[model samples]
Target: MNIDSMIDESRIDDMMENELIGFISTDMSDEEVLAFIDELEAEEDAREELFDHFAN
Candidate 1:
């Protein structure tokens, strides 16, 4: 999936609200979040199954 099109402020907010995702610090900025996504995407097996595991 295209991360740029797949995620946005609203989606991140929902993830945080539902505790579906976590951050090391509450002070994280949007840039940091995008960087994290980039890091994940760089991994060899960052597949839909992995994402589904987290979503569920």
Candidate 2:
């Protein structure tokens, strides 16, 4: 499935409203923010891999 097809504005808005996502502290340092983004990307990659495996 295409990632773009799986997301829309409402989904983005809902994610923004989510407590865990909404509560990200502005106090985070640049390094901390980068690390957090890297972790999220890694998780997304893993999820995609699992989806692809299952799809086939």
Candidate 3:
């Protein structure tokens, strides 16, 4: 369930096998990945709100 471990194990090289493995690995319980994306989106939304507030 650890991505650092997964990242280490991931065969991310300049080849088709590496590319396939990267995408395929995502197929298994990508919760942490989704959560990271959600956090990024929330931070972006907050920044936009702050900017608009100050610009007004």
The candidate maximizing TM-score is: 2
Identify the superior model by TM-score, candidate 1 or candidate 2. Answer: 2
- What does candidate 3's lDDT look like per residue over 1-56, in tens digits? 46753443352222334433455455556786566556555655675577558756
Assess each prediction's global lDDT (C-alpha) against the native: 0.56, 0.61, 0.52
- Model 2 gets an lDDT of 0.61
Model 1 agreement with the true structure over 1-56: per-residue lDDT tens digits? 55753674356446544542655355878888777766654541345456667777
Q: What digit string (tens of lDDT, one per residue) describes model 2 on residues 1-56?
A: 46653764346445434633754578988887778767666665676677668767
Misplaced by over 4 Å in model 1 are 1-20, 44-56
Q: How would you order the candidates by lDDT, starting with the best?
A: 2, 1, 3
RMSD of each: 8.9, 4.4, 14.9
Model with the higher TM-score, candidate 2 or 3 = 2
User: Cα lDDT of model 1 overall?
Assistant: 0.56
Check candidate 2 and list the clashing pairs: none
TM-score of each: 0.34, 0.61, 0.49
